[model samples]
Target: MSSSIYSTRRWRKLRAAKLALQPLCEPCSRRGKLVPAYSVDHIKAIAAGGDPYPALDGLMSMCVSCHSIKTNARDNPHAFGKGWKAAFKGCDLDGRPLDPDHPFLASSEG
Candidate 1:
């Protein structure tokens, strides 16, 4: 059994809608990978004062692997150590970084 919030019909509908909207994992897609998403995560955690049911844009679709990585990094930072943020390695077909937070994606001033 999961938490009450997760078991609610509203939450279920929202999760389903989000998954339908983005069947592929957002992070994986950014990495140029075509992995199916198995989870719908809140962009801002409800425990952190985020809306319990925000718009679709406020949610993220993620595969089990990406979801676990994000959850661990956010909920158990100490356990993951200092280098937890950039846990994903390797590059896309264009040689661009696979990690969404990679410096290559950052805006560079001319």
Candidate 2:
């Protein structure tokens, strides 16, 4: 939580990349909507011992809400059972699997 995802060259690169690709958000793309990119999430996290880029296959773009969810899960593994190991398992604050595509699974490929 202290020194993870939030601080990374990859995130910086991703933020710029997202703008290059589209100013809109990815979820909005799926919904046929166009919204600004508030956060470029890992779709995976670091504390969970993940490599964001490799895990998501380069799908590293999310909004602030999305990014925070991933960050929370990564920061609180003990609160979750089995550590919620998946590349696309978004859950509530409690850590129960939410929408599989909620965008928090890219933490690692292992």
Candidate 3:
């Protein structure tokens, strides 16, 4: 989150365009929710060697709550760590959709 890159007109336009293109919280979508997204996030953050201005593939739209949680987790990896993966364990090995009664679904039900 460099100030210089974030302040550019190009970044602003891209953010707006991305939000319009996919107006749903990406993380929520994967979990079968329909939250509207208002912020664009980088899948690979700039601090993690991602491009300062990445393309659509590296970007996602997210709601304020989702954004805050993700940012907080990322900012403090040790506390949150990689526990986020547990949330996605509902998917198949390759992240494919599984049967409704799939055992993995139980992990997310609680």
List lDDT for all candidates, in order.
0.76, 0.51, 0.70
Q: What residue runs in model 2 are displaced by over 4 Å at the alpha carbon?
A: 52-57, 65-110
TM-score of 2: 0.46
Q: Write one digit per residue (lDDT tens) for candidate 1, span 1-110.
A: 22568888999999999999999997788777899999998866787677778799778899998888877877785855433356566776777665544567544312
lDDT of 2 by residue, 27-58 (tens): 44444446666766544344345565443344
Sort the predicted structures by lDDT, highest score first: 1, 3, 2
Better of 1 and 3 by TM-score: 3
Lowest lDDT 10-residue stretch of candidate 1: 101-110
Q: Weakest 10 consecutive residues, lDDT, candidate 2?
A: 100-109
TM-scores, one per candidate: 0.72, 0.46, 0.72
Candidate 3: which stretches are off by over 4 Å? 82-89, 92-110
Better candidate number, 2 or 3, judged by lDDT: 3
Of 1 and 2, the candidate ahead on TM-score is 1
**Cα-lDDT of candidate 1:** 0.76
Clashing pairs in 1: none
